[model samples]
Target: MPKKRGKKYTEAAKKVEAALAANGDGGLAPEEACKIVKATSTSKFDATVEAHIRLGVDPRHAEQMVRGSVVLPNGTGKKVRVAVFATGDKVREAQDAG
Candidate 1:
């Protein structure tokens, strides 16, 4: 069984649907989506943003497995420096990404 949502959730869902319709198939820009989310927020506590991705891969097959990571633009509150060690092609790829 699934839990029922409250009025706030329903309103936010409607706003999301409207934004999707206005943006058409291309979808909303990252900035626009953020604006909509912030505007529709009804909770007093801080809200979190996340992503759910689907890919074609078999977990049992090592060669076909996929893995990746992303860095948040707002960052974690602490300040820190990051380091990466790579060899050959990866070194070049990291440099290019930088």
Candidate 2:
């Protein structure tokens, strides 16, 4: 059986839906959406945010794959986690460098 959503989860979903409805344009500003995400997050860890855009390409066709990134002149302030994978003395170097 699938797990059921809790009261808090249900309330958060409803809140987000209402907020979206209030935006008659059917779109939320990036800042406003971020606020809602932060407000409705009940996890102990930081919430993960993802955005989807349609490019009108069939993903099943490898030739139509789209992948690239544009770095902003001013870096985003989001925290990033780095991993140091080494099997030998390099591990010690990573720790010392940190």
- Predicted model with the maximum lDDT: 2
Our tally of clashes for model 2 stands at: 0
Evaluated against the true structure, the overall lDDT of model 1 is 0.83
Model 2, TM vs. native: 0.50
lDDT of 2 by residue, 1-98 (tens): 97899999999999899999999876787888888999998999866689754567997999998889999786898877779998799999989988
Residues 1-98, candidate 1, lDDT per residue (tens digit)? 87899988988999999999998984777788889989898879998878544465788999988778979798877977667799999998888877
User: What C-alpha lDDT does candidate 2 achieve relative to the native structure?
Assistant: 0.87
Candidate 2, residue 2: lDDT: 75
My TM-score estimates for the predictions, one after another, are 0.48, 0.50
- Model 1 scores worst on lDDT over the 10 consecutive residues at 49-58
